[model samples]
Every structure is written in C-alpha cells, then in structure tokens.
Target chain A: MRIVLVPGVPALLPSYASIEDPVADLRAACHHAVAELGPRVRVLASSPLGERVARHLLGAAGAEESEADPTGALVVANGSAKRTVKAPGHLDERAEAFDDDLRRALVQPLPAGLAGIDVDLAAELWADVGAMPALAELLTPGTTAEVDYDDAPYGVQYWVIRWS
Target chain B: MLELGRHTFADDATLMMAIVNRTPDSFYDKGATWAEDAAFERVAAVVEQGAEIVDIGGIKAAPGEEIGPAEEKARVVDFVARVREAYPDLAISVDTWRAEVGDAVCAAGADLLNDAWGGADPDLVDVAAAHGAAIVCTHTGGVTPRTRPFRIEYDDVVAAAIADTVAYAERALAAGVARESIVIDPAHDFGKHTFHSLELTRRLGEMVDTGWPVLVSLSNKDFVGEALGLPVGERLTGTLATTAICAWAGARIYRVHEVVETRQVVDMVATIAGRRPPQRAIRGLQ
Candidate 1:
C-alpha cells in the first residue's frame, strides 16, 4: 500500500487562491505525491480543517475518497509555523529544533521519533503533529520515504513525502 | 460576453476605457495630448496602466469652436489608424457623434464608436454595424450635441434613462449590430443637471437590469465637481467615491482620465460586492 503526506496549508485550497500563487512549488509537490496514491485513498487528519485540506488535495489529484478497502492513505499534517519573526505564530526559539526533529522523523523508514513526539512541546512550538501517529501503523518496517518537497517558505515547515 | 470588434470579454469583466483627447479644448486634460505624438504617448501610458480601451475624442464635449465633420475626421481618423497599427491588441474606441466621422474612424480600424452625444446622429448605429464594431448608446434627454442642461426636468430621471438607453440599445440591435456588441450609458452631465446626475448614479442598477452592459463616463465631470463644490483638478476623490457606488451597482465600463485610481476603486468595490475575489488575501489565512 502507498502512503503520501501533505501539509494542511490553507493557501493550497481553492478558496484561498491568489492571482499569483503564493505556494506554487508546495502545491505542485502535494499534487504529485497525492496522484501517486492510486484511485481509492483514505484520508487521515487530526482536525476537520486538516481533513478538508486532505480531501481537496485528493480531489485535485483525481483520486477517489474511499474508506472501504482503500489502496492508499493520505495524511495531512505539518511542522512548526513559528520558525521566524514573520511567521503566523511569531518567533519561537524552540521551533527550529522541533522542526529539525520532525524532518528527521519524516525521512526514517520506521519514523519512531514521530510516534513518540511530545504533544506539549509540539503545541508550544506551534507544530501540527496530530496526524503523525497514524503513519506509524500504516507504514511497515521496510517502507522508505521519498521526500518530494521540504521547505519553510512562509516561515512554516511543510513537507511532501511519499512512502511505500 | 462583450464582443467589442476584435476582442471578447466575459460578462463579469470590468473594463477601463481611458480618455485620450485629440482636441485642444477638452475639459480635463485641456491640450495635454492634442499633438499626435503626445496622444500616442498617452495611449502607451494608459496601456501600461492596464487600460482595456482608449476612447479617443476629436472634439470637446462642451461647446467651443464649431468642429465640422471634415475637421473631426482629420483629428481622429489618422490618429486612430496610428493607434490601431501601434497597439494591435488594444481595443480602440473613437468618441464621436457624427456618422461621417464614425465611418472614417471605423474604416481606420477603430473597434468601438462611443457616441457620447446620445445618438443625435441617426446613422451612427449603421456605421458601427457596418464595421462590425461595438457602440455605446447613451441617454441625453434628447438634447442636441455640444449643448448643456439649463433647466431640464424629468418626472422620473432614472426611469427616463433606463427607457431611453434601452430603446437606443434595441435600435442598435435592430440596425444589424450584434447583440453582444451594444452597450448603454446614462450620459452623466450631458443634458442633466447635478441633481439628475446624482439620481442616475444612485439608481444605476435599474439600467444594469436591462441586460445591457452599462458604461459610465463620470471622470471629472461638472456633476461630481458641483456635488463636492470642488474644481476640475480636485475631483478625483469625488469621482472615485461615485465610481465605487456605480461599481457596486454593476456598471461594467468606466471612461476616465485617471485609469489607475479608478481601476483600483472599481476592483475594490467589485470585491466588496462579491463579484470579484481579493487579489492576494493571506492576512489571516497564512
């Protein structure tokens, strides 16, 4: 089974679109990763907003939203949004280290660090990791991640990763 | 869709028709662009400022010296050809009330005939139809060309405007002009006093409801100046304020001297009216 991850960036939705896209590269990477997740994909997200974003990405990728014997899973989550003074949540000294740890957790074949993330620290750093624990059950031991996109363009850490 | 000769625009599209006066006695610019080179430069400036059309006029709307058809053609025909050749993609409009000058400009590659004199010339629509060009049919309470309103009174000004302009639009349609190529205007300050103009501005939606695209030439006219008690050069604020009101009322085209400011006002009003999306909204969504 294939599993893909995309950030729950509001700018990626049609309602928040601009004449010139602010997250062009990130959106393209999300579409690319989501398209690789076959027709029947189940969406997993922490909150309602995250689920909406995940579903929008799935629709944009021409994938069917199915929970009955799904072929793949789409996870919606992102790291710290407080990486700089210009960030949405403003500057937090712990944001860089927290995002670094999240980046490390995303690339590992097992992602043990993601499953064991401290919820309090993640909240303080303005990181969204509620959907990460589901990846631990979906990805098997030998499954490896192909990091398609990784950036902090808007002072928010977003990654587009595909696992199989 | 609005089929303006060589160009077609979506129904919801708002267009800016920048004024390019080729005469020496126009009210706003005076003689700023009277010379051919100066007029061409004006076209370039407005085009850079994102104007969709240029309304070139040979004679000032307010009466001064009597300009015959020969002089009017001399002023606008070659200039229209020059502009058409230079800006092949731009929608070229000639502001004239005479069918003779309209024919000459249309033959010179003008895309639209802006009859600001309220169709005093009966054959203007035929000229527009013959050239496959668009026409702006305006209401002037049946006033003669180059004349001002002294004591004109209408029982229902808005109703009169809607009826007259719609009838003119139907006349154009019956004269072989394409359905999408006809537009209506309630020629503000042409034959109406300040009170009449204000009433027209306040209830412009009735004209919009006629299912004809409405064009408003409200740039630094006497009505706005008289409303605010300001001079011609200081009427931008009042003009934009009135423009916002008209835009909210669904006016499609704006003929103006200040393109950039008017465009911004129209866009902002359209956005507020829910007809247009914000240009780049990331304030809280980021």
Candidate 2:
C-alpha cells in the first residue's frame, strides 16, 4: 500500500492563505506527496485540525475519503513546534534533539523508533504524533522511506515523507 | 473589466489615478510641474510609485486666466503624445471639459477623458467614443467649468450626485461610449460646499450601487482640508482617513496627488474589508 506523511502546518490550510504563500515550498512538497496516495484514501491525524488539513490536501489532490479497500493512508503529523524563540510554542531546549530523533526515525523507516516516542515529551514540545504509533503496524520490513520535504521554517519542524 | 483604451483591468481592481497638472497654478503642486520636463518627470515618478493612470490637466479647477481651447490644447496635447510614446501601457486621462481639446488629446493617444467639470462640453462624450477612449462622468451640480462653489446647495447631496453622474454615464453610453468604459465621479468641492462633499464621502456607496465604477477625487481637496481644519499640505491624514472609508464602501478609483500613500491606505482598507487577501500573512498561522 502507498503511504504518505505530511505536516499539520496551519499555514497549509486555505483559511490561512496569503497572497504570497509563506509555506510555498512546504505546500508544494505536501501536494506532491499527497497526490501519490491514490484516490479513496483514509486519513490518520492526531487532532481535528490535523484531520481538516489532511482532508483539504486530499480534496485539492482530487482524492476522496474512503476506508473499504483503500488505496493508501495519509498521515498528518509533524515535529516539535518549539524549536526557536519565535516558534508558536516558544523555544524548548529539548526540541532540537527531539525533532532530530523524529527525523532519523521517519527517514530510516524505523517503526520501532516511532513506536518508542515518549508521549509526554511530544506533548511538552507541542509535537503532533498521536496517530504516528499506527505507522508501526503499517511499515513492513521491505518498506522504503523517501523524504520529500524537511525544514524548520517558521521555527516549526515540518516534513513531507512518502513510504512504499 | 474596465476598458481604459489600451489597457484593461479587473472589475474588482482598485486603481490610482495620479494628478499631473500642466497648469502653472494647480492648488496642490503650486506650479511644481508646470514645465513640460517637470511634468514628464512627475509622470515617471508616479508610474514608478505604481500609479495605474495619470490624469493630465491643463487648467486648474479654480477660476484663473482664461485659457482658451488653443492654449489648453497646447498645454496638454504634445505632453500627452510624449507620455504616450514613453509609457505604452499607461492609461493617460486628459482632464478637460472642452470637446476640442478632448479630440486633440484623444488623437494624441490619450486613453480616458476625465470630464472634471461634470460634462460642461456637450460633445465631450462623442470625442471619447470616436477615439475609443473611456470617459469619467463627474457630477458638478450644473456649475460651469473653472468656477468654485460660492453658495451652492443640494437638498440631498449624495442623491443629487448619484442622479447627475448616472445620467451623465447613460448619456455617454448613448453617445457610443462602451458600457464598461463609462465611470462616474462625485466631484467633491466642485459645485458643492464642504458639507455636501462630506456627505458624499460618507454615503459614497449609493453611487457605487449605481452599478458604475466610482472615481473619488478627494486627495487634499478643500473638503478634506476643511473637515480637519488643516491646510492643503497637512491634509494627507484626513484624506487617507476618507480614502479608507471610501475603499471600505467599494470606491474603485482614487484620484490623488500622493500615489504611494493613497495606494497603501486603499489596499489596507480593502484587505480589512475582505475584498483583498493579505500580502503575505504568516504571523500566527505559522
């Protein structure tokens, strides 16, 4: 099954659109990765807002929500939002190490590492990872990961990754 | 879409019509650009400042020396040709009330005829149509050209303005001007007192509701100056405040001296009114 992961950056939502997009590169990567997740896909998101973002991206890619005999799964998750002082959650001394570990696990397709993420630390760092544990059950031994986007723009670590 | 001769703009687009006076005693600039080169420099500067149209005028609105048709043509015709040769895409509007000068400037590649005196010349619309140029139909309450308001009174200024300008627009349409090419203006302080101008500004939406694009010439005019009791040079703040109100009310064209400042105020107000998107908003969304 095809699987793609996109960031739950609020700027990606249409409600927050600007004339000159602030997250243009990130949005392009998200759209590119999401488009590969064929029609009639299920979305896994940590929060309602994350689900909304996933649906918006899916709708934009001409994909619809489905569960029966689904083509692929779209996961809305992101890294620490407190990587800098100007971040939404402000600077956290432990954020960089946390996002670094998350990045390594995502790019390496390490299901065990993703399953071992400390929920307490994730919450404290304002990271959305509640739905990520399901990724452990989906990633097989032969699965490969490709990072489409990786950045800490606006002090928020965002990644667009595809695993097949 | 607004078809201004060689250029076309979106219906929702807000335009800045920069005032470029060829006269020696225009009120705002005080003869600063009376010379041809100086006026041309003004055109280049306003264009760089992002003005979409330039309203070129040979005679000041206030009463002055009797500038006959020949003198008016001499002041604006060659200058219009010069600007037309330079900025091929710029919308050049000749601010004249004489049909003869309108013909001359339109022949010289002028795009719009800004009839600031409220259609004083009966044949001006014909000239605009013959040249395939747009026309700005202003409401002056029947006052003659070059005369200031002395004791003019209107029972309902906004209603009067809507009636006059819309009728003039229809007249232009009858005279073969395109429906999209005709624009209406509430000539502030043209034939009305300070109170009349203020009421027009406050209720400009009535004119906008006429289904015609509204052009407001409130840039440092006597009405704005009198509203804040400030002089011409100090009325930018008052003018911007009025401009914001008008923009919120959906006025399409702003005729002004300070193009940059007026454009900023209009854009900011349009954004606030949900007519335009924020240029690059990421503050809390990020």
Candidate 3:
C-alpha cells in the first residue's frame, strides 16, 4: 500500500505580491508534508520550482515527468491559506475547469507504478470541493479517503487514493 | 467461449457495446454512416479499453432517420462480418428490430441481438430463439418520436418499465428463447426525458430485482448532457458519474463509448460497494 499525497495550492493569493519568496514557502510546505508522512514520500507537481523543491526533499533520482510508474505516491497542495472565495458568476465553471486541469496535469504525470495517490485540498476552499469523490473515482479509482490538515490556517482537505 | 444461450462470448471481461450508427443522420455520430474503417478502429480502441462486446446498427433510431429493413440488414451484416474477421472472439451485437438483420448477423458469428423494439417483430424473436442468441430487449415505443413521445404516461414509470420488460421477456421465452438468453435495458434516452431517465436510474434497484442482468446504456445520452450541460465529446466525466451510479445500483452490464474510463469507474464503484474484492490488499499491511 504505497501512498502518494497530491495537495492543491490556490495560486491566486493576495499574499503572492507581498511574499518575498513563494518558492521558500512551497519548500517549507513540502518538507512539512514529507516529515508528517515520513521519509518514504514522492511528490508530484506542475510547477518547475515545486518539482525542484520536491526533488530536493525526496532525493530526486531517476524522477521522470510521467505517471507511468505506479509504485510512488502523490501529494497536491493549494497555496491559499485562509479565504472562502467563490469565483464570480460563470467563473465557478472556470474554477472547476482549473481544478480539473490541475488534477489531470498532476495525475496524468504520475508513474503507473504508484500504488495510490492522495489529494490535499485547500482548507479555505472546502466548500468548493463538491463532487471531488466522483472526480477521484474517475481519475484514480482506488481506496479514497479524505484527511484534514489542521496545520495550515485554513484546514486542508486531503483525498487519499489507493490503486485499484 | 462463454455461452449465453446459443450466443458465445469469448472474453470474460464486461462487454462494452459501442453505438454504431448506420443511419446517415444520427445525432452524434451521423457522418459515421460510411466510415467502416473508422468504425472498426473505434471498436478496436474500445476492445483495448476492456470492452468484450461490440454492437453495430444501420438505422438511426433518433427523431427522423429510418432505413428500410433490407438496407438495415445489408449494413449490419457487412459491418458484423468485417468486425468478426478483425476480432474473431469479439462478441458482436446487432442493433435492429428486423428479423432478417438479426438472422444474417447471427449467421455471421454475431453473438447478441439488441432490439430497441423489444421483440416487436415475430421473425426477430424467432431468429433469436432458433439460434440461441442473447437478446437485449430495450423499451422504445416505436421508431418515430411522434409515435413515442419523450414523456410517457404510466401509473408508475419504474414499475411499468419493469413490467413491460418482463412481458417482453415472457414473449421471448414463449418464442423458445432460453431464460438466460435475455438481458434487459431500461432504454435510457430512447423516448424518455431527463426526468424519466433519472427516475429509471434512481429506481434501478427494482430492475435488478427482476432476477435478470440489467444493461445500463446511459453513456453520452441526452439526459446526461442536460444534467451536466456538457456536449457529447465533453460528457466523459458525467458519463463516468452515471456509470458509477448505475454500477452502484447493481447493473451487471454497461453500454458505453469510453470503455477504459467506464471500466475503471465501474471497478472502483464495485470495489467501494464490496460487490467485488479489492485489486490490492487493504488490510494487515506492515
């Protein structure tokens, strides 16, 4: 039962302009997740800096940009810490599309050998996590469980997906 | 080969009957009327996605497109023969109400009959009964939308639909078709509106209660599109959602276009529901 955690990060944040180093914050979050999940962890990300941060933490050896290997784990994190923000009007659809795009970009890149992938949702966006179970069922199709990450200001929602 | 009455399916995986339109005016795949190789490629891709059955049809049972019985038989036979040769063990189901087409395809090694008319033609029933072929009885009032309105007046839609299917089953049985030779499909978008389709899906437990396997054909249907506001090409997510719900409701068969994706959805739902064992161990791991 190898586990992978993929956390969704809200990139559009009020703090993005003020923060001196977003990369440092992302690296800290990755370290926090690895330390919590233990030493045996592999993280998947779309951002080059995030991938670099993950490689530094997970000993980036033979890490490829594909999800063909099913032995590793995936963890996705959304960057926003505290905000119940709803996209205005049809922007909800765009949010959904963004969420979907992010999910596909992360999961599709995973190696098929990874046993299961888990998603960590932004705590502030819990209300926006509707129909995630169905989406997880479609994309991952294994043992799925939602976890609460209370460390972040907004409690993050985590979906743990085991391989079918 | 696993025998369903006289019909034989070589694969053990659940069959996915891809909708092949012979009519030149189908709502989604209308231009597919003359693309035999493309149709065959679709079948191959579906098979790669774990579909064990392929259903071929000549007439578009939609609003205004209807082909004659002779043309229907010719088209179906030609397609089935070509598919059978390409994939010998593939279970080919002929979608037609005419007996001649059913008879011709069954002779061409086609394994099943998917009749939307529910054995309305005696010759079709006779052909199925004579050959021991598996028959999928779907509820379509008639070929034309005018004859079969989108909204049907029934005392209890679920009960009436089940009863109608049972009655069709009885007729097929009386016509010498074996009991196991028949499967029931609620006919999700054929003359039924979105509400009706959802009602049928919600009450799918009742259909499974009939002591027969149920084939759910909600893949890329109009009701799904209406519910999710997605077009046919973009409806994969919604279609997978419906497939998951139906599998949860205990539908043994699913007729879908996205075979690999649908198979994964059904497998996951089945695993979660405990209907089947998990592919990997979930307990006693160190």
Best by TM-score: 2
Error of 2 at A125 (Å): 1.2
Would you list the clashing residue pairs of candidate 1?
A: none
lDDT of 2 by residue, B158-202 (tens): 999999999999999999999999999998899999999999988
Chain A superposition TM-score, candidate 2: 0.97
- Candidate 2, DockQ to 2 decimals? 0.86
Better of 2 and 3 by DockQ: 2
The residue-level lDDT of candidate 1 at A44 comes to: 86
The per-model lDDT (C-alpha) reads 0.91, 0.93, 0.61
Off by over 4 Å in 2: none
What is every candidate's C-alpha DockQ against the true complex, given to 2 decimals? 0.62, 0.86, 0.01
Q: What are the per-residue Cα lDDT tens digits for candidate 1 across A75-156?
A: 9989998999999999999999888888887888556777889889988877888988888778788888999999988888
Q: B222-286 in candidate 3: lDDT tens per residue?
A: 89899988887778888888888888888877876667788888878877776555454311110
Q: Write the per-residue lDDT of candidate 3 for residues A7-104, one digit (tens) a residue.
A: 44332122222224333344354444444433444455555544544455455333333344434454444422222232212122233333444344
State which docking tier applies to candidate 1: medium
Chain A only: TM-score per candidate:
0.96, 0.97, 0.34
* RMSD of candidate 3 to true structure, Å: 16.7
Which 10 residues in a row give candidate 2 chain B its minimum summed lDDT? B277-286
Compared with the true structure, what per-residue lDDT tens digits does model 1 show for residues B1-286? 9999899999999999999999998988889999999999999999999999999999999878999999999999999999999999899999999999999999999999999988899999999999999999999999999997889999999999998888999999999999999999999998899999999999999988889999999999999999999998999999999999999999999999999999999999988888888887766565
